[model samples]
Target: MSGPCSRVDHMPSENPFDDRLRVRATEILRELTGHPEASFRDGQFDAIAALVNDDKRVLVVQRTGWGKSAVYFVAARLIREGYGAERGPTLIISPLLALMRDQVAAAERAGVHAATINSSNATEWDSVLDSLTGGDLDVLLISPERLTNPKFRTNVLDVLLDPSRAGVGMIVVDEAHCISDWGHDFRPDYRRIGALLDGLPADLPVLATTATANTRVVTDVAAQLGDNTMVVRGALSRDSLRLGVAPTASAEHRIGWLTQHLGDFQGSGIVYALTVSAAEDTTRALSEAGWNVASYTGRTDAEDRARLEQSLKDNDIKALVATSALGMGFDKPDLGFVVHLGAPSSAVAYYQQVGRAGRATDNADVLLLPGTEDANIWEYFATASMPDEDEAQAVLSALSEADAPLSVPALEPLVGVKRSRLELLLKTLQVDGAVDRVQGGFISTGVPWSYDAERYAAVAEARRREADAMLEYEAGHRCRMRFLAETLDDPHAHDCGRCDVCAGQWWESGVDDSSTSGARRILSGIGVPVEPRGQWPSGMATIGVPLKGKIPVDERVSAGRAVARFTDLGPGQVLRSFLADGAQDAPVPKNIADWCITVLKEWEWEERPTVVVGMPNTTRPVTCADLSRGLAQIGRMTDAGPLSYTRDPGSPDVNSAYRVQNLHGAFNVDPATAEAVDGQVVLLVDTEIGSRWAMTLAGRELRKAGARAVLPFALALRG
Candidate 1:
C-alpha cells in the first residue's frame, strides 16, 4: 500500500542455496538478454528466488521493461536443472501469439527449450506434446482459450496435470490483469485460471505477471491465486517516456496531423485507432502519402499479424495503424513513439498501450491525438462488450432445452443474438458453470444459474469512472503519467516532469493546409462495395422461412455499392450525423446525393439499371424516398416508386435470424411495379443497411416478380 513499491511483510528468510541460485539466475539473465555481465533488476531476483527456492505463488507488478519474463524463464530453468526436487515443464498461459513467439526466442537464448501450442501451430501439437512429457521441453506456452478446448484439454493438458507423473513444476500467468472482471482487458477464458490454480499441486509455485494491474486488479488476482500468494509490486512510472496529448477538432484534422507530423516522431512505433475502420482509414491515408505503414486489426490474419509485427520491429515500416489487437505481448525495445488516433476508454488501458513504447529506449515519445468523436466510440464499445441479460437468459434457456450440444450457428436463431456476441456470452456462461463447451458445441450444465445483474452494473460503473479519468488525462490538467499512475492507485505517482503539461507541450501541433486538403481529398472519395448475402441464416427452416444453405444465384442481389460505411473515418462522420439515432427523416443532403451519383458513375456494372425501386423505409422513409428519386433523376432512370411492406417488420436492429424472418413475407410489389420490373435491371435502394435482410428479401421479391437482376444500393452501410 506504500509508495514506489510494496511486498509481503515477511519473506522467507535466506536459505544457504540463495546465493548460488542468484548467481545462476544472473548467468541465465545475461544469456537471455544477450547482455554480458547483466544483473537482475531490483525485484527480479526476489521473485525468481520466491518461486524456485521457496515454492511460493508470486504476483509481480512491474513496468513493461522490468524483465518479468526473465524471472519466469530463470525460475523454470532452475527448477528443471535440479534446483529443487519438483521438476517438469513450466506451463505459461500467455494471451497473444506475438508474445509467445518473443518469449520462445528469449527462452532459447537462455538454453531453455520453449514451445507454444496455439491455434496457429496445430500441426506441431503432437510433436510439442511429445517434447513436453519427454522432459525435453523446459517451458510450454498456451493461450487461456486452450483451457476450454476439448482436444487440448484431453490430449496435452491432461498429460501436464497427471499427478502420478512429474506433472507441471510451475505455472505462469502473463498479463494477469485479464483474470479480474474489474480489469480493463478482462477475458472470460482467464477466469478459468482460478480453477486451474485450484487443481494444481498445492506446493507447485505459480507466478502471475502484469505491467497494467492497479490495486483493485492486483487484489482480485491475488485472491484468486489463493491466500498464501505473495505480491511484488514496483514503481509504475517509466523514465524513458515523454507523454503528451494533441487536441484535434475532427477526424480529418487528426489524419492530417499524422500525415504531416508522424515523420517528426523519433522512430518506428504505432498509430493506434479506436476501431478497425479507423485503423484502415489511417493506414490508407498514410500509405497514400507515401509513409510505409500497414493496418493491424482483429480482422488481420494471424500470419499477417506476425509478419507486420516483425516488420515494425525491424523498422521496415514507419508505423502500424492498429487497433487494440497490437496492445499486449508485443515487444519492441527500441519502439520510438506511440500516437493514439483516438483515446481508449480507460486510463489503465492507455497506460498499458503507451507502455509499449520506451521500454528499451532512452527517450521515446507518447502522444494522444484526441478526437471529438472519442466519447461516442468509447460508449459504443462500453455497451457492446457487456452481456445483455435477456440475451444471456435466452442462450441458457435454449441450451437447456436442446436435446444435444448446440453449435453457435444452431443457437443463434434460437437465442436471437449475433454470432460474435453469442460466443462471448457462452464463454462467460461456461466460466460461470452455467454451460460446458464440449467437442461438438456447448451444453447446459444443468446448474441453476442466476444472472448477476449487480456485478455487471458495478463493472459498468467502474468503466464509466475510468472513462471520466481518461477525459481528465486528455485535458492535461495534471501530469499525464502521474494521473495514469494515480488512477491505478500507484502511491508513488509523481510528476514525470516531461509530459505535455509538465514540459509545456512537446508535440508538434496543427496540420498544414496542403496536408489537410490532401487528407480531405483522399477521404472524400467514398464508394464501398456492399456484398449481397449469399446464404440465409442456418435455422431459417425453424423460423418458418423454409430457407437454408446458399441463396439461389438467380434470386440473389448483385454486389452493390454504398456511398460510405458508417464506420468510415471521413464521410462516415458526416453520414452518421445525417442518419443518427432519433434523427428526423429528411431529404438527402446535396453532398451525400452527389457522392451517391459519383458511386453510380464509378460502378462498372455489366448492365445498367433501368428502374430504381426504393425498399420500404419505416425508420427514414423521407430520406429513402428522396435518395431513390434523386438517383433516378440523375441517372435518367425510371422512378418506379417505393416497395410496400405488407406488415411492420419492426426494428431492423435485431439478430440475423429474426431480421430475416421478419422480412421474409413483408415485401409487397404492386402489380404496376411488378410489370415494370419485367426483364429490367432493377436498382434496389435503401437509406441505410444494418442487418441487410431488408435489401436481400426485397431483392428476392423483385427477382421473383420477373426482374432480370436486382442491384442493391444503400446510402450508408451500418456496421
Candidate 2:
C-alpha cells in the first residue's frame, strides 16, 4: 500500500538551480511548454537523466497501482528536453485498444504530440504512419500485434532502421511479464516481442517494464529481453494492508462472510472472481444486499468497462466485482479492500489480484475466500480436454501459414472447432510446449519425438494429483499458516492460528464420530483375514461369530468375561468395548467392546489378531514401548505418509503418550489406510498387533489396565 520512496530521500540535497544538467533540463522543458515538476521528482528525473546521459536502455516495471505509465510520460518529456522537438519520435507499442486511448489522452494533457496506429484509426492511422516514417511525429504508439503485419512492420522498420532517425531513442516493452509463459496473464503476442526487438539495433536502449514478477518470472523477462540490461526492482511489499483468508464451504457462504466483514468499511473495493459469471453474481448479490456495486469482465464492452472504471474512480460505485481484465492500467488509491471469492490457479494470480488494494499506503485488507470447490475448478481448467494430435498439427500448420497473427474469430473457421474449444486447445498446446501463441495466432514449437498422448495423459494425471495434494493441505488438521507456507514454498514461518481449518472448530463440531468409526469397522471387516503359524498363538479370540441372518453378538456378563447374545441398542446408548488381549480381569464396556471385538475377528485369523477403533483426534493405533525408538521410527515415516501431528500438551506423562501416538500412526497402515486415518486416532496392541514401532507407539498406554481400544474422545457438541 505504501507509495514509492521519496526521491529526495535517495538523492543529495544540492539545489537543482546550481546543477548544470538539472538547470538545462528544466530550461528545455520550459521551452517545450511541458510541466517540469510533473515529469520530475520521485527518482523519475534521476532515472530518466541517467537513461539520457548513458544513452542506456532500461526496463521500468510497475504494478497496477504503481503508476507505471508515469515512467514513459516522464521519459518522453525528458527526451524532448535533451534533444529539442526535432528529435526523432519514440516508438511505443500499445497492447490494448483501451490503453491506447488512455495513453493518447494523457499525452494530450501533457502537451506532447502522440498518435496511435491501430485499427480504430481509419485515415488517421495512415497519416500517422506516414508522419512516423517522415520523422514528423514525436512518439508513435502501436500494438505489438501490429508489428507482425508485414506492411506495418515494413513501414515502421524503414524509419527506425533508417540510420537517419537516430535508430529509435529507446524501445519500451510495456507489460513485459506478458512475454513469459509462467505469468498468469500471458499473451502469445508477447513472445513475438523478442523477435520485434531483434529487428531493432542491439544497442537501441530497450526498456522492458511490468508491475509484477516473482524471481522466476523476472528471470524469464530478462532472458526474453536479452542480457546486460539494468534491472530495477522497486519495493515489493505493501505494509499498509492486512492479509486475511475467509475459507468457506460454498459461494453463498463466501458472499455472506464478505458482507459481514465489509459492512463498516466503506470505500472503493474490487472483488476478483475466477469466472465472469461469478463476478456478475457476486456484484448482483452485493447490490441486492444494499451495497452499491458493479461488475466487469472480459465480456463487458470496452466502453462499459471504461465507464465502470471511471465510476469507481469518481466514487460512483462503492464496490466492483471483476475478473483480471479490469485491473491493468487502473489506478484507484482509495480502494478499501480486494477480495478473492475463490482461489486463483497460481500464486502469481493471487499476488496481482490482491496487489490492487491499499495503493496509497492507507490501511486496507486483502481477503481470500478459497472455497472447497476452487481446487477442483482449477484442476478442471488446468487439465482441460485437448485436441487430437492430427487436429493440433493441422491448427499449428494453418497458423504458421498465416501472413499475420490471426484473431480467434479468423482462426476458428480454419481449425474447425468452436472458438472457446479452440482457445482452450491453443492454451493447452502452449502449456504442453507443442506451440507458442503470439497475440492472435500460434506458432508450432516442432513436436518433440518423445511426445506421446499417453505421456501427456500421465502429465495431466500428475497435475491432478498435485492439485489434490494441495487441497488436502488446505483442509489438513495442522495450522493453516504452516500448511500454506509449506505448500507455496514460502520461506518465512508463520504462526497464524486464525484459519478455519487451523482452529479445528468445524471438524471438531461436525465430525460424526459414530459414523466415522462405524465405517472404518465395516471396511476393516471386509479386509482379508491374516493367519499366524507357530507357537506365537494363531489368533486372539474375537467378540462375534457369523450366524444365519445376523452377527451373533458377544457380551461380557462380568468384568473380563463374555457371553453370546443378540440384541439391538438405541442410538445414544453407551456400548461396551470388546476384549482383544491382556487381563480378562480388566473392566470394559459391554456392547461397544463386543462390537470392536466382532470387527477385529472378521479381519484377523492367525496373523496378528487386532481391531482398529477409528477415534476422532486419536493419532494412530500402533503401540511401542521404547520412547526414543518409537520417536525415531515415526520421524522417518512422517515424510512418506499423510501428514500426522504429535500432540504434547506439555505434561510429561501425556507427552510420552503423544510421542507414541505420532509413531504408531505413521508406518503401521497401508498408504490408503494411512491417508484415511491421517489426523484421526487408531487402536491396536503389541503382541497381538506386533511390535512395529509405529503401531506400538500409537496403541501403547491406551491398551493398558482399564483402557479399552484407545477410545479417542471428543467433547460432544451441544445444540
Candidate No. with top lDDT: 1
- Candidate 1, TM-score vs. the true structure? 0.76
Per-residue alpha-carbon lDDT of candidate 1 for residues 1-719, written as tens digits (9 for 90 to 100): 11222364224334455678878888888989999979877778888888898888889988888888998999999999989766789999999888998999999999999999986665467788888778799999999999998898998889888978888889999999999989999999999999988877667999999999888888888888876787888788887899988765687888988998888998899999999778877887887788999888875645567778999999999999999989887999999999999899999999999999988888999988888989998888888778888898899889889999998877887877866688888888888889998977999998887878899899999999999989888888888888888888887789989987988978778679888777776566787666677777645565567887778999999988888878776787789889875688999988888899899998889999999999888779999999989999999999999999899886554456667778888999999999989999999999777656788899999999999999999878876
| lDDT of candidate 2 over 509-545, digit per residue (tens) | 1323443343233222221111111111111111121
Segments of candidate 1 deviating more than 4 angstroms: 1-17, 521-524, 528-719
lDDT of 1: 0.85
- Each candidate structure's TM-score, on Cα atoms with residue i matched to residue i, is 0.76, 0.55
Q: Which lDDT value does model 1 have at 420?
A: 69
lDDT of 2 at 247: 44
Lowest-lDDT window of 10 residues in candidate 1?
1-10
For model 2, the run of ten residues with the poorest summed lDDT? 553-562
